[model samples]
Target chain A: MIRGKVVGRYWATKRIEHIPSGAFLEVESAGGARMVAFDVLGCGEGEDVLIVTGSTAASWLGGGKIPIDALIIGSLDETGKSKSK
Target chain B: MIRGKVVGRYWATKRIEHIPSGAFLEVESAGGARMVAFDVLGCGEGEDVLIVTGSTAASWLGGGKIPIDALIIGSLDETGKSKSK
Candidate 1:
């Protein structure tokens, strides 16, 4: 996985039903590059994060129906442990 | 998944061989919070990202041998798709 931060957020009201509820976000990679991801935890701008992508990530989002590659699966704590259950 | 940024990275020189080659990262949630994760792609500072946690995440990291909960599985692009193959 790649490391990064949440720089901003994006919205698209028009989407599929199986797509579930979430928003697309602008992420700045730890390498100092910018990117985007899907968020369900409502991550605000400027939060540090871990990211996952590809067919595996899309599968985790909801199989091939979602058309989503990047997703926020959990939040971490200072000790490298996930804060959310 | 949780939205956040890659604020920092952590290293543990003494670890199991199965732990793989990577570092722990300090992440701040998109909700303006902080957390930690394992990084494999060498994500630097101030990057946005998405994360996965729990047993499923652990399984993805190294099939229970790595003791890793949070991992950086992929990097995202301007769109919500993965940057790495």
Candidate 2:
């Protein structure tokens, strides 16, 4: 998992059929690296988010061979606090 | 896939049980971001390599849920040329 901030939304007309219906968010990690993450949590711009990468992310959509590599798993309650904790 | 150069090897005394046996190489992408990648291709230091991330990398080890995120798939024949092309 990585900590990041949602910068904006990404719009793409063409996508793979296997990709689930969701918003693609542009995120900047704590290290300043930016990437697009698939979001189902309805995160808005400027929100703090928890991101899962790699196979773990691809598996979050219920076990299928999806091309998604990054996923926004949760939105942080506060700047650095999680809702669960 | 991402292009990176193997900079060195990483050593860890302990790791997850599900992790496969292979070399953990330190790689720097073309964008200058450095990361540790699992390698089974016997890539050498300073060699340019092709990398695959996400579930695709985990699937390369025969389809199991592994913690590996980045993997070195192939070592490039030249600086900017692939052996396949």
Candidate 3:
């Protein structure tokens, strides 16, 4: 697992059938590594999130095989503090 | 698949049971991103290699579940030119 901030969203009209239903969000780790992650958690921009990579990520959509390599698993609590700023 | 150069090897004595038998190598992409990848193909340091990540990587081991995230799938030909230097 890795911690990152949701930076943006990605839209892909043409996708493989193996891809599950979800939103693709851009995540940037504190170390500046950026990646696009499949999100089922409805994360918004600037929200702190936890990401899972590799097979475990694709496993979220049941035991079926998928090409997805990254996934946003959780949105961190903001403690009532705004993250958009 | 991603292209990278094998930079070094890793030795982990204590590991989880789910881990398969293979060498762990350090790979650095041309973009300067580095990662530890499990290698079944004997790859030497400085060799240009192709890497597979996500479920595809773990699928190499008979399709069983494993926590491995990255793998060295192929070594690129050097045309008899030295890459070790």
Comparing 2 and 3 on lDDT, the stronger one: 2
- The CAPRI-style docking tier of model 3 reads incorrect
Return the lDDT, model 1, position B33. Answer: 54
lDDT of 3 by residue, A7-80 (tens): 99989998777888889999987558899988876778997765658665665555466888776655655331
For each candidate, what TM-score against the reference? 0.47, 0.51, 0.51
Candidate 1 structure quality by residue, lDDT tens digits, B1-85? 7666777655433222344566677777756555566777878777777778644665776553344556766655567565332
TM-score: the better of candidates 1 and 3: 3
Model 1 lDDT tens row, A1-85: 5455788887777756666677788987744677787876767787755555555455555464768666654443445433332
Model 2, B1-85: lDDT tens per residue? 8887777664433222455788766676787666557889888888889888766776787655465667888887754543332
Q: Give the Cα RMSD of candidate 3.
A: 9.8
User: How far off is each candidate at the interface, as Cα RMSD in Å?
Assistant: 10.7, 11.1, 12.1
| Tens digits of per-residue lDDT for model 3, B15-51 | 3235578876667776766666778888888889989
lDDT (Cα, 0-100) at A43 in candidate 1: 73
Q: Rank the candidates by lDDT, best first.
A: 2, 3, 1
Instruction: Locate the minimum summed-lDDT window of 10 residues in model 1 chain A.
Output: A76-85
Report the C-alpha displacement of residue B6, candidate 2, in angstroms. 0.7
